[model samples]
Target: MKKILNDPKRFVDEMLEGLYAAHPGMLGYTGGDLRCLVRADAPVQGKVALATGGGSGHLPVFLGYVGRGMLDGCAIGDVFQSPSADQMLAVTRQIHGGKGVLYIYGNYGGDIMNFDMATEMASMEDIEVRTVLVKDDVASAPAERAETRRGVAGMVFAFKTAGAKADQGGSLDEVEAVAQRTLANTRTMGVALGPCILPTVGKPGFTLGEDEMELGMGIHGEPGVRRGKLETADQIAEQILATITADMPLNSGDRVAVMVNGLGATPLEELYILYRRVHQLLADQGVSIHRPFIGEFATSMEMPGASITLFKLDDELIPLLDHPAHTPFFRV
Candidate 1:
């Protein structure tokens, strides 16, 4: 790999050091372990705390969202690796306010195992803990088995919705409910043109042809549902929209929040081009978009591609989604 850095083994640590320095008082880590990061002003007494953990390389994801009106803490792992249960428990202990703590993260096997262990450990200490798993990648599983699908960019909506609820002083149950609701209404489809290189591996995790693309690829380089010659931006948007709508059919007067997310290396200009077509297609269906989030909300390490996420909104969710939020990597 031609990436810049010294000692691939220290990649995650060095990155955390820079992240802490950049954010300063806004973000801090538990104990001396940089993997267990939390808001600098954590344990907002009596407020429900939100925590999430997952493999690294997907920034603004499990870590970047920690701040006011978002996650209270995050257990960070190495690139494409799950954080240990001990790290997760450390974050839970550091962020648990008097009210309770809620664990919200993607539906990944490693994360599920580690987070579940942390939850049980916290429960023994008399700390109430709740969990909400995000599963919105429609291509990962059939509609009948959505719960088995993987989580992707749709996590942004879940974090925003649930974080707003917690910031509004909602109970733990209420916050978890809103997170579940947001994810239930969200669906994501991704197309990747290239793969990313892990620091330690020093090679691309997957390969794609010069004139090829994979539809519905996972962030960690998992095989997509289909691979074929590359298509136009409009065609890509249409295919993704068709798949999402088939899973969560939209009707006239339905409101939604659209996110055209860049994987890592895709430019904002290209994302907006895709968004332009998405807008037209949604308008054609009589669906009104309440908000259009266009940018790199989630990413793989230097992966060239994009994902589209559609969050079907309701009267209650619209306001929560619009609620003011401020974090290092996200704001509203």
Candidate 2:
């Protein structure tokens, strides 16, 4: 309930206002609506455009990646809510640089519905659109039903690979292919220690005991696979890595990219501690760490938790992951 703001209803508006104000010429909006955010230098003619949208509160997520080598546009909604189809369509139109547009987002019902509606609407305007839903949360569903799982921090990998492909002059189909490929090779497992309060609601969506944690919890406080007493950092990392490696077995000679992401309230030091374990564990398996991303890549509005994402990599994806990308919150 404790947050710094003037009006509860104006939270998103004011946040976007400040974002635009702080990053002028680097970011902007469409149709005079701040909800439909796009790169300032949008419609880079003939380049396939990448767009994503989801609720707010997860900053640098649906909004932060809109930049030089990432998403071209995004349709933002309220905290943990989906944006309207109209808003999505506005972003699609504004960033459709003549080649086509690709929509990459998590596998959530509201988002799927609205993005599909936007796709249909864009078709009437002759804008070709392709959709790729990120289904990387291994804990959400069994391997056989992974297609039904929710997307998590792993979607960031998809964003990077897909965006790099598009910026490199790949066609719509090519970019979408890279996105799907990246997501298919990614797996994520999260543990939550506390819940985040919504700005308007002014209360935590869920709660955890002072000495407990929930393993494999969703970013939105959805039920996790296990709940029990809190464990040490190394223990948490091992547990998460066990599940991830089981799902996507890492071979002795395989190379991989790892990300230890904070769920908002966790500090940078803690993230690095988690990453250290991840790196050591992977090394023990003879897997080389091609790259490591440790930070608050995605969040739940001050939620206390962290997620580990393992992205099985090959020669093709390494370059894409290493590609220079610049956004307000992320750079590589």
Provide the TM-score for each candidate, comma-separated. Answer: 0.99, 0.99
| Model 1 alpha-carbon drift over 4 Å, by segment | none
Stretch of 10 with least lDDT, candidate 2 = 57-66
RMSD of each: 0.7, 0.7
Question: Each prediction's Cα lDDT score?
Answer: 0.94, 0.93
- Candidate 1 residue 278 Cα shift, in angstroms, is 0.4
> lDDT per residue, candidate 1, 1-332, as tens digits?
88988999999999999999999879999978999999999989989999999998998787999999989999999998999999999999999998899998889999999999999999999889999998999989999888799989999899999999999999998999999999989999999999999999999987899999999999999889999999999999999999999999999899999999999999999999999999999999999999999999889989999999999999999999999999989999
Residue 22 in candidate 2, Cα distance off native in Å:
0.3
In candidate 2, what are the lDDT values of residues 100-201, reduced to their tens digit?
Answer: 999999999999999999999999999999999988998999989988999889999999999999999998888989998898899999999999999899
